[model samples]
Target: MPTRWELDKASIYSTKAGEKDRTYLDSAFCLTDDVSTPSRHEGRQVAIGKKVLQTLLTQLAGQGSALSRERTALVVATSWSDESYFVTGVSGKTDAPAGFTPGEQVAELAAAFALGGPALSVDTACSSFPYALDMAQALVNSGQADNAIVMALNTVLPPALFLGFS
Candidate 1:
């Protein structure tokens, strides 16, 4: 029989105040809000999508997601990778003043939550979430981690990108 990996916890963050009860029945969600927390690493801004994921992850951790954080793998999926640049624009900073390593969202999240297992970001356009899920399952199945957190975020899209996708 195949080992079952049950979902212990799930959290969601949206424009509306649906974070407390992050569920499919959230009654029409939107991502156009300026919902973002300040970055810890300078010169590196956190995109809206990352911000949303961070909030959800924080909620999970706060409510005790039953994760052995250090043994948990994190995989984030999204098509907007370079959104930090657009959000940051031209900040006359010397280095990554805020957000770590520049363009490395996984690194920042891992550091924030202290996830010591394999963590990575996946960008395969529209299907990135599934790809990330596969990678997460592979990590857990391969014994690299005890469990995994798969986050898919696509929000605060710029006008041009929104048009293209539309």
Candidate 2:
């Protein structure tokens, strides 16, 4: 028989709130920063995404077995990965500051938590979060990792995309 995998811990951040729990559907809401903010090195989405990851780590730390540079996997799902640079044409400029790519964000978080597992970034439009979760679950189930961190972030709206839709 296949071993049953259970969701050990999870965290969420949004325009409305942030949450963390062991069960999948916990309804408790915690006050969090507004999801929209000015475009900068530490933009709104990146800030919130970091907060969500930190919250999850804090939760795990409370349990006395914090994932410290362990072989833990990281999976991030985002519709836009540092699109601000592209929208503002900063990416084309020679003096563009280092923007937070989705993969880079994951790497930073993993490094902060001392996680050494595989890292993945997924962009599947509206279903990005679900896909990230699936990937994390697969990593854990396949014995590739004992723990996995899955994060989904959607930050600033691209003016071009907005104009196209409008």
Q: What TM-score fits each model?
A: 0.61, 0.64
lDDT score, residue 15, model 2?
A: 29
Query: Which tens-of-lDDT digit does each residue in 1-166 have in candidate 2?
Result: 0111111222212223322211122364543455464344434456666677778888888999788446789888878876543434443556555666777767766776677898888988789999999999999999889888887766554434433433
Whole-model Cα lDDT per candidate?
Answer: 0.60, 0.64
TM-score of 2: 0.64
Which stretches in model 1 have alpha-carbon errors above 4 Å? 1-28, 31-65, 87-103
- Residue range 1-166, candidate 1, lDDT tens digits: 0111122223222344434433223364764433244332232234554565568777877998756788988887877754444534234566543333323767776777788899888888789999999999999999999988888755434444533432
lDDT of 2 at 59: 87
Candidate that scores best on lDDT = 2
lDDT comparing candidate 2 with the true structure: 0.64
Clashes of each: 8, 1
